[model samples]
Target: MQTIDMTEFQSIDLRIGTIVRAEDFAKTKKPAYKIWVDLGDLGIKKSSAQITFHYRPEELIGKQVLCVCNFAPKQIADFMSEVLVTGFSDIEGHIVLATGDKPIPNGAKLH
Candidate 1:
């Protein structure tokens, strides 16, 4: 695996946000969801995440999640994804969302 310096990791804008809206990304070739997260001062940002294996649209709403907010927007199908929702693969290879242990203010940067 490649390694990056602490500075590089710190440069990534990893922040906590609350999922305000979620819906199926029907236009995507793979099953996915288009989520809108409310990032406090940052406002709402959209993301396209392929997490259908473990998450449902209704279950995602109001959930707090971690996101990498500084990346450039990506175009998937007809939607433009604004942030990268961070997650890890479970033992079964399903995507498990990255989140804080407790509730925190939105837009709180991960230190």
Candidate 2:
């Protein structure tokens, strides 16, 4: 497997954020949700997640999730996604979110 140096790893800004809002994203080819995350000092950011298999829009609110915060904004259909909600694929290839075991301050860095 390819490995990255410490600096390269550090360059990836991974942080915890709370999901403030979520809604159905109808304009995309695949099923996804348009979500808003409260990142504390970083302010609220938008993301598109294809996690419909395991989550619902209402259930996502107030959920703390790990996010890749430094990526450039990506345009998905009609949405501008500003952060990446990190997750691991389950044995069935469905995504399960990466999250903290307990609640912590938003915008907390993953070290």
Candidate 3:
């Protein structure tokens, strides 16, 4: 395993945000979703996530989730993803979103 100093770890701008919208990303090679997250004061950011196996667009709305806010925007197919919607792969290889256990204000930094 690798270890890092607290300062280094803190630099990873992980934050909590809410899913403001989600839709099928039909242009990507893999099945994915184009999602918009409302990060409170940070505003909304976009991401393309390969999470179609376990989630539906309608269900994702208003769901609170964790995100890597500092990553540079990436272009996937025609979509320009602005943030990374963090999650884990399930036993079946489907994604399970990373989310706060309880409701928290959007854009709250993870400590």
- Winning candidate number (TM-score): 2
For model 2, which pairs clash?
none
- Clash totals for all candidate models: 0, 0, 0
lDDT of 2 by residue, 1-111 (tens): 999999999999999999999999999898999999999999999999999999999999999999999999999998999999999999999999999999989999999
Per-residue lDDT, model 3, residue 101, is: 92
Candidate 1: segments with Cα more than 4 A from true spot: none
Residues 1-111 of candidate 3 have per-residue lDDT tens digits of 999999999999999999999999999998999999999999999999999988999999999999999999999999999999999989998899999999999999999
Candidate 1 displacement at residue 53 in angstroms: 1.1
Residue pairs in clash, model 3? none
Local distance difference test values of all predictions, in order? 0.96, 0.98, 0.95
- For candidate 3, what is the lDDT? 0.95
- Where is model 3 poorest over a 10-residue stretch in terms of lDDT? 86-95
TM-score of the candidate numbered 1? Answer: 0.96
